[model samples]
Target: MRKGLPILLALMMASTAVGARAESIGHADLARLNETVGAIGRRLADTDARKSDASALLTGRLAGIGAKGQWQVPTFDTLAGKPTLHTIPVDFMLAQLRLQTGGKFAPNAHKAIANGAAPALFIRGGVMSLDELAKLAATQHPGAIEQRGQSFIAHWPIVIWSDAGLVLSAGQQLELSTGEGAFVLNSGLFTIDRASLSSTPEKNAILPEFRPFLATAMTGAVQAREARFSNLGYGETGVTSGLSIVGAALYPAKMRSSFSDSSFVGLNAVSLENARDIAIVGNRFQKMVGPAIAMSGVTNSQILGNVMMGTRMAQAIDVQNRTSDIEITGNVVLNNRGSGIFIANDARDVTIEANLLSGNGRGGVSVVRSACIDISDNVIVSNAQVGIKIRASDALSLSGNDLIANAGAGISVLDQQKGALISVADNAFSANKSGLYGGAASEVALNANDFAGQSPILLDGEFAAYVPELLRMSSSPEGAPQAFTIHPNAKSTTGQTSRPDCKTGS
Candidate 1:
């Protein structure tokens, strides 16, 4: 009996260590951090940095060669041979630090992934209900599942551990039983199809730490279709990854992820970082606290057929960090506190077309430090700032767009003297405070643009118009709305129609 007891203990240890070795985003960083902490002890360690303050540290970055910011680690993605400059997230660093100092570090994702849902709940997935899943898991891990009629509750905070896949779908209701309850995807497939993840009683109302959220990491893939996330996320670290997918950009492009026909209500924006080949379509974003969709280092993806409304203090769509080859089209972004679309950080080869951008607090589209961007065939109206503001960019072509009645200039090209290439043609501008600002008229080649029957409306009004000091005129530019045509059926989610005649709509 004594010999058998040792054998039993060995089996238990093996089970606990099943996925001890896995791939994680910051496992190597965590190792190096430990070494630094040991050697340096207190010196040079940002001791005040905590897991809760991750988002605040994201702002510390500098551009150009040989400029050191606060970051100590090299970035995962490289540009042409130069290492990308970015700060290691403070909260993420703090998350690992706490684990090491007092607890255990989060293990890397398990190497082998099962084909379907969580192995404990699903033998082989063909779509099962929560009741069946809880029953099956109860036999192995007792008290893990609690039931209340149609809703099932998890005994603890849900972590789809490195080796696991969780597919919650088919009218299932998995309530976040605790305020700190969350669903973390670590190198696995997390699918929420026709299912819901919600803290119905609103845990945030009581314990602020009870923020329920969904975060994916370590090359994890998310497939959410017709799913709903409510009362789920906060803007701080440890819980900030609200409906987020932070993938490795250099990872195989064939590994596709998608979020379509879903709904995010009263949550932090959907964030995608270092992700590739994703499709975000037919989603409804409502009353988000910040940018409805925040993307960084993402490539070869499409943001289409989505309706983003009532974003607070940020653009509806914010793309940054050299994210190239993306298409932001067929989306209705309006009434946001910031710009409609904001792009920056040398991001290139983007198409912003067939979108209805109106009533934004900032520019309809703002591009900075990006290149090879095309903005066309959209209604940019009633925006608080310029319809399209370009700075420190190259190869920007703005054609086939209607810029009307904006509080600021229709087009503001701030860096044309700095060798930025902007070619504007076949666009209609009406009632803009300034048609064009900055850029020299001599620098533009106007042979391609027809300058027939044009009206000079660049702040030449008697009632004191609002215009920037500088103006860039294109050989008495043409108001040729006829040259451009949009799809006849283009309409926003609120059923607001986009004008196909290239004319201003009431």
Candidate 2:
């Protein structure tokens, strides 16, 4: 039933790399490796009475018909030169893993017995992720280590670890809350447009340790919009916490991933780290425990036009680490249990504009250890704490904004690090407990700020609110009130938040 006389008797190396596209077989050892594995599948099928002969088809041919009448084939388009990588069909890989345990393995494994070789294969399945695979492998069969960087000598020595390219088109439904949760890691080119991927609540009790999640690795690319991800995640840490793009930093500039016009409910967070060229826009995040969106070490991204509410105990937007070149624009952040926006840990070169920040538990905008941040044209109203809390930051501009009805001061410049310059003007301050609460160490210049009840009251200095000369706008640094040089490297972002619908949070 097979072709050619290419007899493959020798075992493959413990780790073998597969090319992305099928080319001519170059090395004799590779040809032998393929043919030998093919022969091993046939031999296992002949003796393994528990499995039907049709299940033994190991090639990437017609797998059994799916519940939806679609065929399930191997989805392997992986990187080059990865250790323990294989290009065989997924079923073929599963078959080969069954041969590693020699007929004594867990119930999850596909059983087989080698006539001359003693079927001893243990390829792990039904686990949530690769990290969980490492922990749960020994539970299936002892002394069976399939972790990366470990050496295991099976009858067929090559390891079978591959990445997946998952696509859920429109009008499709993917169930994640099955008995064996469907956790897809090492993701590649994932696209789910107008589709739904969710977990059912009733199935949560059967399995306790693992929850379903789909995350990307180094081979990352995503095009998800108008999609829904709900009730999927485990804890508040790791990429498995929710729908995440973890460590997929190799995305090209042009093929940026975006998750927009979507809905996420009852998840921990849309967590991302060490990735680039991403856009999270026009989405709704509700009932999230942590920040609705958490980004760290990301670059060249945008978070725009989203509505984030009902977060339990975290900010709606949290940008941390060495992230840069981001725009937080046209979003509605309301009633979060924490601060509305939090930018810290040297997150620089960001623009926060045209957003509604109200009804949050903490300050509207919080900045610490960040530079070159611009906050303008935002309605900071009715928050439980101060409108804006800045500490140890430089080159921040607050212009053409409204701060009203906040429980604390309108703006609190807590710690004024040296060389930090804040330019405040053309903003309305009304119904706050105080306006412009800063110490003598705060290097700020205020002009034309329409204060209603309270005005610029320096804690350590005298009140200069009604002084017309001090409030006069001055172009020269020496003539300006609280004269100091604005950071020359930082661009001036004054009066730039005049988009016609900025107030609409569109």
Candidate 3:
């Protein structure tokens, strides 16, 4: 029995030592240990197990490292051109992985062969199992899945360059202005600049295929593709991202706080040049200094559900120069220094609806030299100027809108410099200085508009009231209603119909 016990104890000690050896400590301090080791001997010792294992590990892990020369290891210090996995034939490595995973390791070959060389790959890089590559491309990346008690990492095949990138919670965003193609974010976050966010990306040199990934929640989960944006003219360090607003409210409530003493921070935020598709919503902006949202030369973007506080500027929401197909809806522009919503020259096909504008500086909504606008269901009230002001553009329509209590007119049209045509219908105007104000009467056509103000009338530049019969000249009423300045009698129906007169051809 004593002999058996001694043998059993010896066996246990052997098992512990074997386990510790299997766990294999490679030098607690690799730098110090390598420095202490001096240099490798001149001649190759065929029987040296330690040298072979170190070489094998380094060679095995070399390709797995990213393209950007990482970790500056002494193994990479070239005294001799020892075996590097990077220099080895890719076919050999692929052959080994093929044997390891029974050919299921062919990440690209399977997709490429099936699609006949169609590039379904979002990014191109290092050899990894099919599963590993797919997981790397996910928004969550390395954290997307866990299996077999190991965290799998993949290597990038190509390198790209970018500056001033933003690493949001969901994905990494970069601005590669110089168009260098060696940038990568295999893990973690980075800041990229704006140049790469614009035309350079579209130049087709290297097209980035963003995969569809789960977006951060505004409400119920949505599958939104991870996008690479450019020219994101940002002055702030980090903007909040990851919340997907797919036909959902950017804000918690349907509306934002009113403009008072200016507590909002987004107003001070600056623009990014060549920027595109920036989601600026769900923020509070009241009593702001600049335009609540000002965009120039931006495209395919959305600015929804934000409040533009009163400002000294000419507009709360101003879009300028070649900006197209922008959607401005469900916002509140109150007491702004200028017009509530202003679309300027070269801005086209914008949709402004379901917004609330009160006490604006100029008009409620002003559009200049733009076309194909749809202005509907907006509540404009107490603006110092007109409720809805449109000038110098064509094919514009103001329908199903409510304009009330403007200091001047409810809706005003002037100086159609572009020979643009406008149609105003089914709108309600109440308690404005004048319900509808116009310059060239014949240029515009107003129909089915309900006006319920005391002096509901269109006027000339001189405030000479409108007479439908004398469409060209400004005129006042005659006799009971008055003249030069026509005052419609509150009692009489004809008085209500009568307007200022116009001299014949003069």
- Please name the candidate that would achieve the greatest TM-score relative to the true structure: 1
Off by over 4 Å in 1: 1-129, 140-143, 161-163, 204-210, 236-239, 249-254, 439-456, 459-506
How far residue 218's Cα lies from its native spot in candidate 3, in Å, is 27
For model 3, residues 1-506, the per-residue Cα lDDT tens digits are 10111223222222222101011112233233222222211111111111222222222112111111111111100011211111122334334433432342232212111112221222222223223333444543332222222222122221111111122223222222212221121110121111111112222123232211111111111111222232221122111111111112221212111111112332322231223444444334443345655666656666565445645444777787767777776665656788888888878768887666766778889888777777876666667888888777766768767676678877777776433456665566555666567664224544344432223243434224333432211122222212121222232222122212211211
lDDT preference between candidates 2 and 3, better one? 2
Q: After superposition, how far is residue 3 of candidate 2 from its true place, in Å?
A: 92
Candidate order, TM-score descending: 1, 2, 3
**How does each model score on lDDT?**
0.54, 0.54, 0.40
Residue ranges of candidate 3 with Cα displaced over 4 Å: 1-273, 312-314, 440-442, 454-506
Per-residue lDDT of 1-506 in model 1, one digit per residue for the tens? Answer: 10111223222222221111111112254344234323321221232221112222222110110121122121111112211111122234326423432332232111111111222222221223355556765666565467776677764334443334566767877765433233343344566777877754644324454455566665456677777777666653222535676654333322367777677776777887777878887677777877888888788888876667778768899989878889987666667899999999978888998676777899899998887888876667668999898887766677667676678877777644333346555555555665556542112211122211112343222211222211122212344111211111122111122211211212
List where candidate 2 sits over 4 angstroms from the true fold: 1-164, 203-210, 248-254, 453-506
Compose the digit string of candidate 2's lDDT tens values, residues 187-249. Answer: 345566677766544443344645566555453556676778777776664466667765532
TM-score of 3: 0.43
Q: What is the C-alpha RMSD of each candidate to the true structure, in Å?
A: 25.0, 25.5, 32.2
Candidate 1 lDDT score at position 418: 39
